[model samples]
Target: MIELLGKNLTELQAIIVEAGFPKFRAKQIMDYIYKRYIFDFQAMQQLPGNMRDWLTTHCAISIPEIVTEKTAPDGLTKKLLLKLSDGNQVETVLMKQHYGNSVCVSSQVGCAMGCVFCASTTGGLYRNLDTHEIVAQVLLFGSLLKERIHSIVVMGAGEPLQNYTNTINALRLLHEKEAFDIGYRRMTLSTCGVVENIYLLADEGIPITLALSLHAPNDAIRREIMPIGAHYNLENVLAAVKTYYEKTDRRVTFEYILIDGINSSIENAHELGTLVKDFPNCNVNLIPVNGNEHIQLFKPSRRQMEAFKNIVASYGVAVTVRKEMGDAIQAACGQLKVQHAQKQSE
Candidate 1:
């Protein structure tokens, strides 16, 4: 069945016309669904009972059902297992921040990126999520919390850039004034350095922040953790990022995950600085590494992390260590989905 909730006003109008309803009814449906967040046709008071019944029979408004929920001790992070229509479950995380509640949405049932440390890519790629499924994740999470989300990160279970078109369409729906109306700037798209999509996203001209999962400063270390790193080597990835900056005029955020004795050295920091020194607008964000079970590396010692950051900064590269959030709940990126998949397979 076709999904109705993710369609924008213009697309909804086309669907309404095709469904033999007056085109004006599309705006009425939009008001009920987007403005009121009501999916029940009976709740659409403006629509006639007959029309509501017709809509119910012809269209489906899909929302993921909560299969499991784990809340952190601090009461700030909630990890949810969302069972999709196909009975496959994907994970979404609701994190409470000082600014407001932010949700991370998954873009695929499984991932193809195959970042060795990430469980989402472990069993191989399953299938890509449609635009509707992606948007539903945010709506379902927000509806349960009873608080409007102020920001969203497409950095959950799947590599969003791998499913480029649908990911972009979902982002568009998320920002629609009639729907979530989230500001484009508040939305971040995190990629594991998909060079082509970086250029594609820049060409779209949206000012949304772009995050590169640059776990290593150079190609050799990256290939050890992320197999795709071999195909898109550091040379090519850095050049693509340079082009992206030129086209978008936006500072790219390079995400560096610090693993003990791995890519956490002062030399690695110097290499990082050299790679990005020319791009004055970019910032390198240091993430104390998590997901040690999949990867047998410990989080860097505070001293080591600080030393690395200081060295990079000494080279005139702006660097900041990302504060850990929802650590008690295993809400550190990719942890929840990995746990859920293990349980299911057991």
Candidate 2:
């Protein structure tokens, strides 16, 4: 069955016309799926019985099945392990902040970027998720909450830029006015310095925030933690980030995961600060590395984190330590999915 969840209006129109239905039927179907959030065609009482029957036979509004969900003790952060049609699973997160609700969506089943501290790549790469699968993650969360999701962060599980086409298409579908209508600025796509894709995104005209997983200050240190750094050097990555800023004028965010003794030193902070000092619009986000037994990484202490931030701030660069959330539930990306898979296998 054709999954209609990710198709744009033009694509839907083509499908309707090809199915021997009037062009207007596409709009009608979209009204039910996008506007009303109705997935079952039979529940769309406005359509004729024959039309509904034909739709039931030819099309499906695909949504991932929630295999498991865990809510943090805070009661505001929830993590979901969703199973796709083929049995592969990915994790999505719902975070309730004071301003609004933000959903974290995954772009691939498993990750290829083997960042030493990240649990996502422990199992290695599986496959990229289709556009429908990516969109379905947000829709599934929204359906459960029965409220509008304020924003999305494509920072879970995998490198979004690696699956560039599907990632961009999914964002477009989510931004469709008839559906979620999430503003471009409200969306953030994080990449592990995919330099070429960064240049491509700069030209795409979308104003979504581009976050780079820098992790370390120089190529020497970065290459030790993130393998992607070997191919795309720190200098080249910053150049691409500058190009993105010039093209879109969007402030880029550099995600620096502070592993205890690896990249959390004051010297590292000063080096990072100098690197980004000349950039027109950019900020550094310090994430205290999440602990993963399988990965053998330690989280930085509060004092260590604050000192590093102060050092960076001294260089006239904007910096903020990411607020820790959902710790009790293993809220970090890939933590829940890996644990779930292990339990299932046992």
Candidate 3:
């Protein structure tokens, strides 16, 4: 099926001309897809019956198929298991905030970056998603809500930088005024320190917020948890992050997951603070590790988390404990679709 969702105006125009329709008709279809967020061709009453039939027959306004949706009791978070055309499932989340609705999108079906603590990589890599599929996830959720999405976080099942081309293209399509109309600044891309992509992102200068999954400050601990750290190391990752800040004039966000006695000690906090001391503009986002029944790990107590934040704060590093979302439905940080998939297979 032909996917019309990811096409820009020019591409849509070309499709219309090729289909023996007037070029102006493409603008109408674009308006329906973007401005109206209409997925079913029948909803577009302005189009002639023949054109609608033709477009519906030849084109697919594709969106992710929801296999299941689990809404947390808080009513602000919904976790979805989406089945792609190939029958491979990926996760996307709709998070309701006072600011507005925010959606998190996955770049690949599964992840190859073997971050030991993550479930996305436990299944190993399947394949990278196309630009169309990535955009479809956003369009699927945004269209359903009928409200503008205020933010996007590319911190889902896969490492976004590993799928850089498609991720960037999807970002561009999502930010298009004719599409989801999300601004570039509202988007955040999280990476597990894929050093080269940091440099590449700096060259592009898209002005999206950069979130480094710096679960640990030193190379030793990071390497133990994240396989990528073995190759790039903490020093290399920080260097690239600094380069990114130098080029974009934007502060990087270091995501540190407080895995109960693993990387949550005061010593680690001091080390993390010192690591960011030179980069005073950078901020630390402390995340409480999300655990499951299979994993005996536990989330840190409120006091413990606060102590870590205060320790970093004392070093003059701006830091905040990231608010946990979808906890009732087990949607905390890495506990979304990944854990579910593991449960199903077992």
Candidate 4:
């Protein structure tokens, strides 16, 4: 069946027009899907019975099924294990912040980046999610909440820059006026230092915040933790990041995971500070490394995290420690999926 979720009005219009239906039928279908959160064509009462029947057979709405859900004690976070049509599953998160709700969407079934501390890469790379699959994630949550998600973060299971085309297309589709109409500025795409793709995104004209997972200050520490650092040196990565900032004028965010005895030391903090101090409009976000059933990573003490942040801030760079959220439930990306996999194995 032809997937209908990611196509724009022109594409949808062509499909219906070729089938001897009026061009306006595309608009009607979009109204039901985006506005009413209707996926099954048969439930579109306004469309003619024959049209609906045709859509049901010839077209498919590839929305993921929420097989399991976990909610935190504070009721501000929800993590869902979504099963795709092909039986592959990916995780999506809904974080309820004081300003508004933000949905975190994955770009692939499993990650290939092989970040040592991440559970998302345990299963290895399966496949990149289609544009519709990525777009469907947000709609699924919006349907459940009975409202639109205020913002989107492409910082879930996969390296979004690795699946560059589909990731970008999904964001563009979500930004369509008839669709969510969420501004590009409200979106943030995080990648594990895909230098080439970072350059490509800078030219895409989308001003989404670009987040680089720079878990270490220098190439030596980074290569030990993330494989991408070995492939692309810190200098090259920062050059690409610089180009992205110059082109988009959107402030770049560097994600540094604070593993207790690793990258959170005072020396690492100074190196990190010196590296990005002159970069225009940038911030360093220090996240405590989350431990999981697969590994025994450790996070620095609260005082240590503050000390690291202060050292980085002293270099004239904006820095902030990410507040822990969804502790009652498994909040780390891929943690829930890994647990579910282990249970099935047993």
Candidate 5:
């Protein structure tokens, strides 16, 4: 069946016209699916019975099944392990914040970046998810909350830029007026230095925030943890980020995961501050490494984290430590999915 959720109005119009229906039927269908959050054609009472029957036969609104869900003790963070049609599961996180609700969606079944501290790459790369799969993640969470999802972070499970086309298409789908209608500025796409794709995205003129996973200060230290840093070094990645800023004027966020005694030293912080100090619009987000059994990395002490942040701030660069949330539930990216998979095997 054709997955209709990810298709834009133009694509939907083509599908409707090809299926022996007027172009206007596409708008009607979008209204039912997006505005009403109705997926089943049989439930769309406005559409004619014959059209509904035809839709039921030819199209499907793909929504991932929630195989497992865990909510943190704070009751503000929830993570879902969603099972796709082919049985591969991807994790999506719902974070309830004082500002608004945000959802973190995964772009691929498993990651290929091979970041040593990440749990998503534990099983190696599986495959890039289709646009529908990516978009379905947001819709699933949106439907569950029955409220607006204020922001979206493409920072879960997989490398979004690696699945470039689908990631872009999914973002567009989510931004559509008929759909979630999230503003471009509120959406953030995190990449592990996919320099070419970063350049391509800059050319695309999308106003969304671009976040770089710069776990370490220099290439030597970065390559030791994140293999992708070897090919796309910090210098090249920053150049691409400069192009992105010039093109979109959007402030880029550098995600620095502080691993205890590894990348959390004050010297490392100073090196990172120097690297980004000249950028026109940039912010450094320091994240203490989240615990994972598969990875031996440990989070730095609160004093260590604060001292490191102070050094980066002293370089005349904007820096902030990311607020910890959902730690009790293992809400860190890829942790829940990995644990769930392990349980199934046992």
Candidate 6:
């Protein structure tokens, strides 16, 4: 069945016209699906009964079902485990911040990156989600909030750049005026330094913020932690990001995960600063590692975290620690999904 949820107005027009319906019918379908939040074709009262009946047979408006939900004690953060049509589940996070509500979406069912600290790699890579599946995550989470999600972060579960086509298409659909109407600037995409895709995304002309997961100051330490580092070294990754900034004129954000005795040393912070200091207006966001059963790495102390940030700032680079959110409910990207799957098997 054709997925109507991911199609933009132009694609929907072609589908409708090819199916012996008027082109204008596509607009009405868009209104019902996006504006009215109606998913069933049979309930679209404005459409002719015969057209509705045809749509029901040929197309589908699918949304993932929530399998489990965990909310933090403060009520500011909620994590949802959504089960897709094929019974594959992915986790999405809703964080209500002082500015607005931001949602984090997963690009694949499971991850292949093998980032040692990330629980998403616990099950290996399952499958890349379809474009509609990716878009549905944002829409479903937005509906739960009962308000428009002001920003989106594709930093959950899988390596988004690995699922390049679908991830990119989902962002485009969400930015459409006929759909979510969210601005391009409100989106942030995180990658484990996929060099080829970094160059590719820069040419696509989307001005979304690019957050490179630079956990280590050099290639040697990165290889110790993330398997992907063996393939693309820090030198190449940093160069790709530099090119990306030049092309898009958007400041890149370097995401450094602070793990105790690993990448949290004062010297490591100075090396990090030297590596990124020459880049034009880049920001370094330090995230304290969240230890799980699978990864034995622990987060650095608050004093250590602050000291490291101060050293990085001395290089005339902007650096700050990322605020911890949704800690009580296991809000890290794949933590909830891993726990749910473990229970199902038991």
Worst 10 residues of 2 by lDDT: 29-38
Write down the lDDT that model 3 would get.
0.84
Each model's TM-score?
0.95, 0.97, 0.94, 0.98, 0.98, 0.97
Candidates, ranked, lDDT: 4, 6, 2, 5, 3, 1
lDDT of 3 by residue, 190-278 (tens): 99988998999999968888999999978888988888887997888899999998888877899988888788888998999998888
TM-score of model number 6: 0.97
lDDT of 5 at 310: 93
The global C-alpha lDDT for each of the candidates, from Candidate 1 onward, is 0.84, 0.90, 0.84, 0.91, 0.89, 0.91
lDDT for model 1, on a 0 to 1 scale? Answer: 0.84
Error of 2 at 35 (Å): 2.9
Residue 17 shift from truth in candidate 4, angstroms:
1.1
Per-residue CA lDDT of model 6 for 276-331, tens digit only, reads: 89889799999999895457889999999999999999999999898889988888
Q: Model 3: clashing residue pairs? A: none
Q: Supply the TM-score for candidate 5.
A: 0.98
Clashes of 6: 0
**Candidate 2: misplaced stretches above 4 Å?**
none
If both were scored by lDDT, which would come out higher, candidate 1 or candidate 5? 5
Pick the winner on lDDT between candidates 4 and 5: 4
In candidate 1, residue 23 scores what lDDT? Answer: 93
Question: Backbone collision count in every prediction?
Answer: 0, 0, 0, 0, 0, 0
Residue 180 in model 5: lDDT? 79
